[model samples]
Target: MVEVRHHYATVRGHRVFYREAGAREAPTLVLLHGYPSSSRMFRHLIPALADRFHVIAPDHLGFGNSDVPSVDAFPYTFDSLTDITEALLAQLDVTRYAVYVQDYGAPIGWRLALRTPDAITAVITQNGNAYEDGFVPEFWKPVWAYCENPGPQTEPAVRAALSLDAIRWQYLHGVDRPELVDPDTWAADHHEVSRPGNDLVQLALFRDYASNPPLYPQVHAYFRERQVPLLAVWGAGDEIFGPDGARAFARDLPDAEIHLVPGGGHFLLESHLDTVAGYVRGFLTAAASPA
Candidate 1:
């Protein structure tokens, strides 16, 4: 095992914090975490895959220890996040990497793969949206409503979503094995999201996500046109996005290899770290192995 190194990369004026491990020349596994949380989501999987790959996990701006500039200072759009992610990867000299998409990571990863289709060798999605029919929770309704009619009223919804209890519920709601999730994990997410004006980032991003409905068609087209191999690991129990959404990936990406985790949630990557890592490594290795 290699010693993990924490560092910073200035992107769009945010000192984006990240952890880099594994040899520079090794295959890179780029991790895109969800909103209201940061690279911290990948804590368990990072070490599992580090020995075989260069794992790069960054705290998206306004999330984790990364920047939290005023919502006025930043757009908080998924497109903007995609831009920042691309710039950071290029600046770091990462080439031909596999994207590990989880939660909000799906949208960000979709935009990245669209722009630089060739840069991606494969994609591994764990409980991320690639299909349209997956189960979505009741909590997302208010946020979606606000996205439709964004205004000062949207502020309350954002505040509600970013609330400590709300975030804790999102992280731990569907876990079959509750003990696997440490209270500290949710504590850290709740704390980071509680930062001043941090709630606004959540607001702005979710608002922009309302506009994201159109992008999915484009994303579907890109996957079809590029034939990018995808391995979707879904926790059927996820309250956010359900089994139907997981199967939806198979609709657009007919060949997308799907792994349905019997009991997992938004944090399935954490709960099924070894199984997910094994599936991902196998996909990457087999794809690159000329078979």
Candidate 2:
């Protein structure tokens, strides 16, 4: 079994925790997780890919094992989160690496790609969105409303949406085999969100997500210009992102690979670990090869 080591790096005065595995000489693969979850989400995937690639999975500030600064102390915007992640990578001497992104990770990964297009070797997205076409109106309605008018009236709804029940729903909603998904996933997430003042941090991020849509055109333009090797493996049944998000990549990067797992939910790794791993191993092997 491949061993995964946990470590923390001081980035911008915050302790950013991350999981690392595989040999240092191996090509790097950075894994960025989604909302209410941390590097913990990659526990299985890290080991699976560690044999072929050096894996780095980090917990963004305000989530996972990272320092949970009070909402007032940190901006909690995607841009700030990306800054911390980028700094952490620089500190680790990671100059070039492929990125695996999901949910909130999408925005952060895209920002990194935009900032340093030359640093990105390839892109892998699982339920990570870039285009407006990816948004499921019903799933994003309340979030869109709150982003537009973030006031006392809209705050309550957004807060409620972050509740433990909602977190659980995100895990089991579209999975064909809910029992296969570990309950500990959402339980750990709930524990983090339940921390004092963390709720406000999450709420702030939900509002700041509005900042991402405006950057979609830029992301699309980057895709067209760079023509980066992209593999979009998504959960077809994902209520939040849906299959269209995966297919959308093909529009920009014509050669991009798109696969939608049947009945795989938002957290596709939970239910389809081996399948995703297989695809990733094959894609990265070819993408990382010398031209």
Candidate 3:
């Protein structure tokens, strides 16, 4: 069994927490987490992939075990989050690597790839949006509304989206075996989101999420321009970013591989770790070969 190591790095004066495993000389895979969750989301997948690749998963400034600076102190926009995440990779001397992006991780991964195009070896996206078609109007209605008007009066309606019940719903709603879903996932996510003043942090990011769709053209440009190796593993039943999001990649990069896990939901990792890890490992290996 591969052992996962925990460490901290001081990036831009903030202590960044990350989980590392596998040999340093191995090909690297950086895992960027989703909202209301952190590197902890990759706990199982990290070890699963560590034998063949070095895996690094970090918690953004305000999430997980990392520093949770108030909005007053640090801006919570996607740009700021990506900046800190990129800084963390630089601090660790990780110049070239494949990144696994999910949800919030997609924006961060795309920005990192664009900023340092040569450094990104490949990309693995799981339920991370890169196209307008990925956004399900029904699920994103309340979220977009909050993004349009963010304030004290409007906060609660959007904030309800992050409530404990909602967090649990994200895990089990579309899953086949609700029993297979770990109770700990929502527990940890809820704990982090429930932290003092963390609601403001979430609200800030939700508002910033509006800034993402406009950049879809640029993200698509990267795929067309660089033709970066992409492996998309998606939960087919995800009500938020449905299977359409997975299929949308083919329009840009016809060669990109797409795998849909049946009976999976938004947090597919929780229920489909072994399948994802297998797909990721195989894709990376195939991508490394001569065409």
Provide the TM-score for each candidate, comma-separated. 0.94, 0.99, 0.98
Could you say which candidate leads in lDDT?
2
- Please say which candidate is ahead in lDDT: 1 or 2: 2
Candidate 1 lDDT over 62-130, as tens digits, reads 888788888888888888888888989988988689999887888899888878889988888887786
Question: How do the residues 1-291 of candidate 2 rate in per-residue lDDT, one tens digit apiece?
Answer: 999999999999999999999998999999999988998989999999999899999999999999999887888899999999999999999999999999999999999999999999999999999988889999899899999999988788779867889999999988999999999999999999999999889988999999999999999999999999999999989999988888989999999999999979999999999999999999999997887
Highest TM-score against the true fold, candidate: 2
Cα error of candidate 2 at position 24, Å: 0.8
- Computed on alpha carbons, the lDDT of every model, listed in order, comes to 0.81, 0.94, 0.90
| Candidate 3 TM-score, C-alpha based | 0.98
RMSD of each: 1.6, 0.8, 1.0
Q: After superposition, how far is residue 83 of candidate 2 from its true place, in Å?
A: 0.6
Task: Compare candidates 1 and 2 on TM-score and give the better one.
Answer: 2
Full ranking by lDDT:
2, 3, 1
Tens-digit lDDT track of model 3 for 101-192: 99999999988987899999889999998988888888898888778887777678788977999888888877888898889989989998
Lowest lDDT 10-residue stretch of candidate 3: 149-158
Summed backbone clashes in each candidate are 3, 0, 0
Question: How far in Å is the alpha carbon of 72 misplaced in model 1?
Answer: 1.9
What is the lDDT for 173 in model 3? 77
